[model samples]
Target: MPVYKVYLDQVFLGNLVMNYAILWAAAKLSRVPVHTARLVAGAALGAAYALAVFIPGAGFLQSVWFKTVISAGIVAVAFSPVTVRMFLTCLGCFFLASFTLGGLAIGIIFYLNSGRLSSWDGIGKVIEGNFWPGILLGLIALWAAGRGFAALLKKGKFENLFRIPILINSGGKQVRVEALLDTGNQLKDPMTQSPVVVVEYNSLKSLLPEQVQAGLERDGEADIWNILGSLSESSLSSRFSAVPFQSLGRANGMMLGFRPDEVVIERQGKLARPGRVVVGIYRNKLDPEGSYHALLGPNVLELTG
Candidate 1:
């Protein structure tokens, strides 16, 4: 396999400079942090430019308009579906700067070498003549231009957090659950300091018998086995467990119901044990239209080290 070096020449410099400008414009228009926008734009543009120039059949489409369209595609990929006016304005500004400055540099090199205005061959010669120097100049120019544009735009905080999806049993049926892992939810039993998980009462109604549900609604708490008897006469008391929890700034005990199987959480195409978390059934919806069936509390400890 032959490895091709990415040459830093006049053409490369021009492309990089225009790409940086386009990236800065995208960050401003999208209201995203500049570094993130730049990273996305740079990756997109670099790949597209490489494809356009190096792919065997692609070289035939080389033109200013063609390259501009390619650059626009990169911008679109980096920041999907911006307003048409903003897209056009940013693209237009980048195009003008790229063509004018790049064309001027090419023109200067031609004049210095041949001393006369001529044809496209003159521009090509200019590029070939000062290839290495142009690469260095282009990198410096791109950095300076990017910094200048970024200084004028507002900056935002960027956070990268992990999120996991959970599965829970509701009303004797399995339902998919989504929950946020918040380290800030440090509620625990005052006696044990074991983390408290909160759930709405309405969520567990399907699992509870009518009488038990009514009792909870009337008094806000119910004896654990009293409700289980409504579902079965046999001793199901072993299944009805309680995990201590603190809520509303007060320490209390939470009744825990169990499913025969272990709950699994899927993240990034892999499965993991979230913890031996007790399910808390809530009466009201956490978010009425949200997809999550229940929320997992911090009391759940990881099954693995």
Candidate 2:
């Protein structure tokens, strides 16, 4: 029975670094937006838990149930997931990332110790050996793998990713169209603060007022603004709004958007009506091959039916 020296500072700092890295990797793998403050808080909580295990009366923290609870808490604090499925996804990714890094660390330790794992002395020798290089290599490999997956979804399998049917109801007219969910299309109406769905002008032209359609068809920005201004006195004034958005080549771009009476989106055999959605009219074609008529935003999917 040998006693080992445990430095509180070393344990806390080591856990803090590992926890933050694991959290960031999970967020990237999950494709969820990361908030720096939230990640820091989550990492600090995890690091504090690691320190608690060393306390004289805190042995309960080492139980399986406690580990599960703390892991869930860390993910919830960091990601702020809106649904059970999202929370589970984040948790799974977190575990995957943790296991990957842990495996890499273990492999490195064994490699440095000439593939011997029979004694605790071999583990202690890891401190004498250079450790960061191997860990940094593992991190880079994980990052590259995540990036490669994203590129596959964006470029390799463009058409199969979350393409769904959408039905727009307005002005006693209904327009059925195909939409490709674009997570990057986070455009929202500045005035009403409603999510904006970018739709091709030709696809949704039937639902727009004749004057509005004609106004949107015009080439000049000034004329488009003038027509929209005059619509203030019209009966359908409240339905129309100006949506500001930024894209790859265009900066400070404005699009004409109108509120639909109802919008129904079909996802995996179920119909969902995202609340307060505004349809932003895009004059150009969304897809060259006519695959999708609209670019759907991921934010709208968060709303309940």
Estimate, for each residue in 107-219, the C-alpha lDDT of model 1 and write its tens digit: 54554567533677765656776754554454455556556655653121121132457655444566455665533334433433433444556644555546556656766
TM-score for each model: 0.35, 0.65
Full-model lDDT for every candidate: 0.52, 0.81
For candidate 2, write residues 1-305 as lDDT tens digits: 77678889977887888888889888877766778899989999999999999989888999999999999999999988445666787899999998998777657656766655566786666634546566666666666776777687656375676798899998788998999877556777898888888998898888887788778776765355766887887889888878887772487888888899988998888889888999988888887778888988777887743
Pairs of residues clashing in candidate 2: none
Candidate 2 segments whose C-alpha is farther than 4 A from its true place? 7-10, 35-45, 63-92, 103-138, 156-159, 169-176, 182-196, 214-228, 242-256, 266-277, 282-293, 297-305
C-alpha lDDT (0 to 100) for residue 95 of candidate 1: 58
- Model 1: residues >4 Å from true position, as ranges? 1-163, 169-172, 184-197, 208-211, 217-232, 248-250, 253-260, 274-276, 284-293, 298-301
Among all candidates shown, the one with the greatest lDDT: 2
TM-score of 1: 0.35
Candidate 1, residue 78: Cα displacement in angstroms equals 45
Residue-level lDDT for 217 in candidate 1: 72
Clashes of 2: 0
